[model samples]
Target: MFRVDIREMLVEAQPQMIITNDNLNARVDAQVYLKVRADEDNVKASVYNVANYKLQIVNLARTTLRNIIGTLTLKSANSERGRINEELRHTLLSETASWGIEILRTELKEIDPPEDVQITMNKVVKAENEKVAAVDFATATETQADGQRRAEIKKAEGTKQARILEAEGQALAIQLVNEAAEKYFIGNAQVLRKLEAVERALVQNAKVVIPADTQLINVIGELAGVAPIPLVPKAAASPPDRK
Candidate 1:
């Protein structure tokens, strides 16, 4: 008995090609129909010679079974894209050089994800992104606030230092001026000398001498220094410059 439905898929496919260096070695073809709905697995294995191309229906049976099982598993996995790879790899190995059929390539088509799951995942991912953004904003705000507080504290410290330094300078200046004023008013020997001088001036060749005191002497000396000087004329401008 012979079958052609599985074989024609390879034959009729566009740009179809097959290679069989080791896959069609009939030594390893034991129970090739396992887990498959195909009815004939023990065909004579030489039917491909009848077609003059050595690609009979039975020769490509193993490759067909591989493709069918791979497709079923891929569909059952909801086309999650992992089992699809395993199925394809297994097909290449199982039918390589054995079934005279080899898959050229595999590509994905459309996917139909569950609506509820998609919505839930999308919301969760969006919330996660939003949480990250909020954390960054809070961190930035805290940093700015910290910097402002430090600046204010530094300004206050500088003002306090300046006030303290000014007060210290004022205190030093007041202490010096107070000491100088006290020295000027108390026990100055120059007062006695000024009293003698005032007494000598007041006598004017008369026999009147007042009792000399230090305080009175200071008064007389201050008055004498502040008084204006009197002018004396020269001798007639030397007779009008002698013509």
Candidate 2:
């Protein structure tokens, strides 16, 4: 009795073609796993075509790959390898069904563009990466500049607030001093101010001149609680020498 092993088998092929979208030549290596159908009708066809089925399926797979890839640009074909493999497998299964073959799995192993195209693609990728990096760097710089600007603004505001608070404190102190003087010294505030001035002047220097009509002892006595020392008036000078 003749027996056929309907177990799945692995088939691999490399196809090279020009893409219709860009007229760019490309190559792709693919692999497919398939098995023969075990039904009596399909087995009969397999018996008749199985010898040539492998070659037919390989040729069909190559042609389908070319047709599908030819319709797509090199970029799309490279990026959508899974889709291409699935499409190729489906197309091959439809045609190979007459040979009682069932496609179990399909995969594209490698896709290669022309050397010039590869170089151009690499340049494109590099340029895109550089553009993204430049954008990120510019954004970061702007953020840092904004932070610095805000910090400077905050510092300036803080300085202004501090100066305003200090000025307010000084004004309040002056107001309080004036109020105290008005309340406690009554109309003699001017006399009290003069006494303060004299006190300051004495602290700065040892010698002081007293006005002729002023009572130094009274002023000193009021501030220091000390006994006053009387001053002697000078004798009148003889009438100016004869004219």
Candidate 3:
């Protein structure tokens, strides 16, 4: 007696076809797992058609792939592989029922577009990344500028506050000196100030010029508690008229 092994088998198909949405040609490689039913009623059908069943499945898969992939653009076709696989598996399972074959699963191995399209996609990605980098750089520059502006404002405010404090300190010092002089000198503050000025002038070894006034001399001598020095008189000249 001859025996048939009804275990599942793997099938791979790489179909190169045109897409219906974009009219671009691409290659789609897929994998499928299938097996014949081991029941007695289906065993006869399996025995009669099992040898040619794989070829028929391959043709059906190619047709289904073209139909599914044709409806999608290159980008969508590349992205929606699972949808393609599911659609292909369902169609294959339904059509292969009479042949006593069961489709277990289907998968898309690869989807490759034309070289020119791939290059365009790469350029698009590069441009998008560059745009993002530019935006980030602008944001960072704006943030830095804002921070520096705030720092400068703070520094100016600090300097203004320091100046105000220094002015107040100087004003307070002048007030204290005025109060001390008023308390100690009483009515003699003016005379004491004049003496201080004269003392400062004398300390510099400056020549002193006294005015020819007896009252001023007497006032100074009275302030110093001494007798006034008498001024010498100049003699009259009469002999120049005779020449």
Candidate 4:
């Protein structure tokens, strides 16, 4: 193992390296992960006039690693991630030369949710789906019932109209028949009077007459109550004497 002057290394601040027990740059080829955050950015450390130079690197490396861990844990917070946590690994990389540390790779690992939260999320999804289905069923039933009611009302109204029309037709037919009979009677009154006069003349001239009531006698009592008698020429009695 070679010796390293702490003051020279700190002032030069050259290539970054790692040290394990009493060895300066023993495993500089090997790199470790560092997660430093906002508060720890640009940290500079120099050992006092001191013990083994390798031991100094080792001690400083240990302290640096500890500080890195604390910073990562604080920023990560395990409950909610902060911007400090996201930049932690990168922030530490910039300090590599000053701190004499090499960071191999920073892993921002896969995000995982707690198992109980996942179960609760699934239950919420199921409840929402059931609500949607129930709403659909209720809406369909309401629409169907409303349609049926409308159809029934229309049918009833149609039946009532048909009955009314039939009754009106019957009444109109009866009225027409009665009107025809009354007009026939009123218009034939003059013809009826002429027939009655002829009938009375025939009854007076008849050799015999049959009356529905045999006991009753009908006579022309006076010329004053009667219309003027028609003039009839007497048959010549003298013509019989010539025979």
Which candidate gets the maximum TM-score versus the true structure? 2
Q: In what order do the candidates fall by lDDT, top score first?
A: 3, 2, 1, 4
Model 1 over residues 1-243: C-alpha lDDT tens digits?
Answer: 555443423222122222222222111121222211133431222234234222333344445434443334322434344454445446544544333333344433222334564477589889999999999999999999999999999999999999999999999988984675466545765654555565677777646544445455455546467533333556755455664
Instruction: Give each model a TM-score.
Output: 0.40, 0.78, 0.68, 0.32
Better of 3 and 4 by TM-score: 3
Which rank order by TM-score, best down to worst?
2, 3, 1, 4
**Least accurate stretch of 10 residues (summed lDDT) in model 2?**
210-219
Candidate 3, position 16, lDDT? 60
lDDT of 4 at 141: 96
| Tens-digit lDDT string for candidate 2 (38-66) | 88888778778667677777777778887
For model 4, which pairs clash? none
lDDT of each: 0.47, 0.79, 0.80, 0.43
Per-residue lDDT over 164-242 for candidate 4, one digit per residue giving the tens place of the 0 to 100 score: 9999999998798457436543565554354346457677885444333211121121212543334467897755556
The model with the greater lDDT, 1 or 3, is 3
lDDT of 3 at 114: 80
Worst 10 residues of 4 by lDDT: 214-223
How many clashes (backbone N, Cα, C below 3 Å) per candidate?
A: 8, 0, 1, 0
Q: lDDT tens string, model 3, 1-243?
A: 546568999987656655657887687778889987888767667667556787888888888888888889888987888888899999998888888878999988877878898898899999999999999999999999999999999999999999999999999988985775575556766655754565577789887665655654565566568988787788887576664
Query: Which segments of model 4 are wrong by more than 4 Å?
Result: 1-112, 184-243
